[model samples]
Target: MDARRDVFQAIADPTRRAIIGMIAQKPVNVNTIAEQFDVSRQAISLHLKILAECGLLNIKQLGRERLCEAKLEKLNEVHEWVAQYHKLWTGRLHALKNFVEQEALQPRQANTDNKKKTKNIHKPKK
Candidate 1:
């Protein structure tokens, strides 16, 4: 219900996406995540905050360290939205393949018909 952050907008950044990928494998410390990027720790922290706001991440206080963990179920929103278009694109691409294949076969069939006509015309009348 937090309109301030949206999952899609949270994931739209390359750095944020990389951070998500890293943590999705396993929980990682905020410092460790910051080390992987050229950006400032503050910048990375902002990205982490946005991710947390959108429910895509869960930040844990592990003693003195903050750990970022992936709550990847949130990604199901993206997956479901994309799946709707996946079916449409799959059907369209299949239809395109069928059309191209049929067009390719058409020329070969025409050539065969031409060859039959030429053969008939060249045949010596008995």
Candidate 2:
């Protein structure tokens, strides 16, 4: 798979998602991260490998133990994509808001016009 696709695929799993959240909160070793999940340490190691390959996790070799930290730079692509859709929805919502306001005012205007018409029709000749 391509680099971006690999990253997206790796993140699609709930276990991987939880791992990312945990690492973002604080850097920890594979064993520490594995404790939080029911899976084996080896499975966690595999997930870590995918995350590291995807550039989402930074792995540092601190002597014998490797620590993992959330890299987050690649995540900006997700932010930018969502921001584009946010603008489109915001515009649609604004249009809906304007339509609702105009619709609400229309009844009041019709009532006022009816009142004026009645006053003009029933008035005694001066």
Question: Judged by lDDT against the true structure, how good is candidate 1?
Answer: 0.93
For candidate 2, lDDT tens digit of each residue in 19-74? Answer: 98998988888778989999888898888888888889988989998899999788
Model 2, position 20: C-alpha lDDT score = 89
Query: Which portions of model 1 miss their true places by more than 4 Å?
Result: 1-4, 115-126
Please provide TM-scores, in order, for all candidate models, with all chains considered together. 0.85, 0.78
State the local distance difference test value for candidate 2: 0.87
* Window of ten residues with lowest summed lDDT in model 1: 1-10
Please provide, for model 1 over 10-43, each residue's C-alpha lDDT reduced to its tens digit, 9 standing for 90 to 100: 8899998999999998999999999999999999
lDDT of 2 at 78: 70
